[model samples]
Target: MSYGDDSKKKRRLAVIGVSSLLLVAMVVAVTVGVGLNNDSNENVNDSSHKSTSQVSPTVKAVKAICQPTDYRKTCEENLQKAAGNTTDPKELIKIAFKVAEKHINEASKKSKLLEELSKDPRTRGALQSCKELMSMSVGELRQSLNKVTDFDLSELEKLMEDVKTWLSASITYQETCLDGFENTTTNAGKEMKKGLKVSMELSANLLGIVSGLSSAIPSMEAFSRRRLLQDDLPVLGHGDQFPTWADFGTRRLLAAHVSKIRADIVVAKDGSGDFSTIREALPHIPHKNTKPFVLYIKEGIYHEYIEFNRSMTNLVVIGDGKEKTRITGNRNFVDGINTYHTPTVGK
Candidate 1:
């Protein structure tokens, strides 16, 4: 071992020691950086989770409107309030039906349409549909009422009550529309024409609702007492035998009774001649006749528009067969035609 050799050994040893210290410092710094980063990330996640848990789902304000405890009083109050706040016809109709149902006289129950309402299921269904329409109309009226600024709440309530009475009378009239005219012919023939005529009147203007109803009640009561309410005579028994229309037996009886009204002329279309539009014949119909212009439409399709003035009262358009006969016209809400102007397919 010489002095030069010792110096070289010390230099090598120093170099090895410095390299070991540098490696240890780097490992400690990396461990501390990773631990701090994990703690910060955990805090951020916890805050985010708490926020989500505290949040709530949104609710609608309109749905908060509560139903009334006393359906009558509540309906009346809500109706008045809604009418004052809105002008929706549907609301008015709602008030109307409620009023009618509540106030309907038990002893004075009358309606030609209602006479068979229980016996014929179809009449009941039609009545339900008519009621739904009335409700919808009232809703629309409610919306309109809400928009009016000048109406006091009490005034609106009173007016709505009156409207309800008028509508009730109208519905009753609709029921009795068929009972106005009588046929001395076979019971079935008479009843069928009556049913058809009642349907025709109902399909017309809603204005005649009160007058038509006022006249119909007494007639139904009288018919009920006489057992003449069962208009469908000759109860065509189970499909054992079929009767031909040309036999001239039932047909003659029907023609004789219906013709006496003097307000109608039936022209059966045999395909040999063209039909004059409803527009053409309406002018000739007399107002003084207070009778329907009965059109005994043959089983065929009539594609045209039909319009009737106030004078076209007691009108009836009957088809030989519902399936073979169609009176179709397309009019929608956007077409500017009133909801009542929509076309119908009837028998």
Candidate 2:
């Protein structure tokens, strides 16, 4: 071969060698990428498995607790979402309240929309009533939520009773909303009914849970009695050692006379006392009394309801006894008063 031909052949060989190196580098890169992708997929699967395992126990706990509820599926879903992995019954109850609150709020919004869209007079009236009822239900659920954390096991029965009463009233109000449209035949009423059904179901389920739990548990009073019998007496504080509000004269009289009276005002049903009636004496008290003012109610039934406002601080009522000095009234929810405002004696 000529010298130029030989040099051209050598150049071709060098070009082929470089092409082979490039091909090897590309193959290695693709292999490394595939290996990394497999590792990433394995890691993702492992993480998913771990998360699911962690959540399984919580789901089981929620299912067990919610099994007895009227709306078990709904209770499980809502409690699972709100409580995450917590298995505490108290926490579950709180979450149930929150879910009920949310449901009621949504129902209230829907009712308001129905009220606004309602053209027929009867439908509008019904929706208006429904809106108010839903609003009240939301308020009651919120109050229950606020008080749940403060509940002592000893008072569980009372708490459950109160919860059941409020929720039952809420359910009744929802039914009443539906009843308002019983005689009517309108799409608006149907729509409102559809919107309120979820909220009603949620409230009913909460009530069922509370009732079931209360029934299943042993009497808290019995538990308390056992505890009191077993536990030592707690050390008394300074306030417990002596009466905080006794005046010097009252304190001196306590040493001499076992039954002595000291009061800022005396109210009696008979005309023999300083005031003939509580209503008459209420006006005579100071508007913003700083010190403690005692209102001594004598032994007689006062057929009147009394309300003390926030400004009436430091005023204490000293009754002869709960049965002897009675304040009676006929105010109630049936009288078209809001349940919250139907209290015989309220602040």
Candidate 3:
């Protein structure tokens, strides 16, 4: 070959060699980057799978427990988060009660803050009512918790009744809190509603679990009959003067002789009893009555709007007859009296 041709050929070979080296380096870099990315993704997938696969025992239990509830997702999330990995049913129940109690207490606190934020009197009143009702609900929840904490499946009648009553009361109090805000255009209602929503759900969940507690417990059905058969049959019996609704206490009171009724105050409106008017006798009622305080309202058309408030607990006011004893009042919404304050007899 000639010298020029050989030089040109050498230059071409050199250029080809450089291009091949650069192409190989680029391929290797691209392959390594892709490999690294795939490895990173694989690691993430493995971690995610591991996390989901190892479902906690408590989570499983919560799901099972809340399956029959009205608010399943809420119950599961709340109970699962609070109880962690424990699977014990009793412990789960206690944890559920605690969760409800805690949330209700927090709502009660928030209602006070909401009251402070609101300037409208009606809103303030509603907030105050919410605070009071939430407070009562918390108290009822605590009572239910205590019963569940050291309860008797053997005394199924009393235990079940008590638990059901308290839980129902708690749920009712929460509803009452919301009800006060109803039929009004108040922003506080939304805040109060939002604040109380979860607690109410928790309370309902607690009640549902407790209602099915017989099945949850081992061999509770066998002994449930013992107490219920003996105690419940008579109470459930439909008969004579006492209606189905009246309890043994009220039935006994209604059946008792007039002479047996021990009265702390009496009203006759004819200067025959302890006081002429019902309002006059209210002031004489004991400031604090742990026992039953009987206020015998005689047969008369009393022209007064009576109200028994929070401080007056266990005051049994018996009248002559439903038709015979009449309470009349003229104060009404149309006559300038506020609707709330216009009730003839309020408690």
Candidate 4:
């Protein structure tokens, strides 16, 4: 070949070598880019994991508060749901009671609705009892809620007592509502029992928490579960005639002899007192009072059922003797009356 043709061939060979180098560089760049994209995806995944691990402070507070409760899971979940940035124990308790109130009211409404479906007289009576008792349960829960909200540190002992009493009674009322269903051959009893189970459990759990308040509040250090659990409650004494927790009105009434009581009104089988029947004397007493009002009963086996409503507060009834002055009731479940309504004395 001539010298010019050989030079042209060398130029073409040089161009081919440069193209190979360029292709190699592009391959290296693509590999590096792919590695960087994978690293970026991994970083995004790490951030996502970090986000899921985070928890709300309010939820943390709820879990912590309900940790010691008997129904911890239920309490925690519900309180968490209703908890809106509240870290205050009192507010949490109030919220718990509010939740309980809602559940109890739901049970009450269920009882009424169940009543409409029941044809059995016993079932009807039980539903009626449940309706009334659930109302009482709601009232007691409200009382507890209010006390926790407005309680004074100076009166911590009384506050604990009142809260304990109210919460415990609410649980009892819920149980009593179910009790009315027993021995009946209808599905209503079972239904009501199922419906009321949660309400009762909530009340019980709240009572336990209230009983444990001494551990949480420094001011309640003087109170404890031991004092609350005494079998001899309405305690006669700590070595005295009566316990310190007894109200003045209660102490006075319990200590007083029949002769010492001045009658605001009297009931007798004989035509000697203000009225011949105890029922008649009920309306004569004041609808409300701050001081104790005494009603004296003369000796006789009176065939009557006595009842007092919520409005009749601070009233005392004294009988001549348990054996001599007797009150009798004719109500029974077999006679289509609820056992709740069968008591000789109902409050």
On TM-score, the candidate that comes out on top is 4
> In what order do the candidates fall by lDDT, top score first?
4, 3, 2, 1
Which candidate wins on lDDT?
4
State the lDDT of candidate 1 residue by residue for 230-258, as single tens digits. Answer: 53444332242433212234344344554
lDDT of 4 by residue, 123-236 (tens): 898899999898888888887877765544445556667788888899889989988988888998888888877777778878876766634445325432234243444534
lDDT of 3 by residue, 1-347 (tens): 99999997886575445433332333344335544654667656987555644766556566656655788788988887888777655567778888999999999999899889888676676778777777778877887787666544344445656788889999998887777765555688888789989998888888777766534333435543545354655643345665554566766776777678987888997789999998988778875566667889888899998988656865778887789778998885445333455679985
Candidate 2: lDDT of 57? 56
Score candidate 2 by lDDT: 0.65
Q: How would you encode candidate 2's per-residue C-alpha lDDT over 1-347 as one tens digit per residue?
A: 99999997886575445433332333344335544654667656987555544556556556655655798788877878888877655566677788878877887788788778767666666677677667767766775666444544444555656767777877887887777665454787788777777677778887876666556435334542344452344322233443434445444544442136577889888877789788888877776776667788888988776766546766777777787888877876445443434456764
Clashes, model 1:
37
Please identify model 2 stretches exceeding 4 Å from their true place.
1-55, 219-221, 226-347
Clashing pairs in 4: none
Instruction: Give the better candidate number (3 or 4) by TM-score.
Output: 4
Q: Which model, 1 or 3, shows the larger lDDT?
A: 3
Angstrom error at residue 336, model 1: 4.7
Error of 1 at 254 (Å): 7.0
Candidates 1 and 2 compared: the better one by lDDT is 2
TM-score of each: 0.27, 0.50, 0.67, 0.75
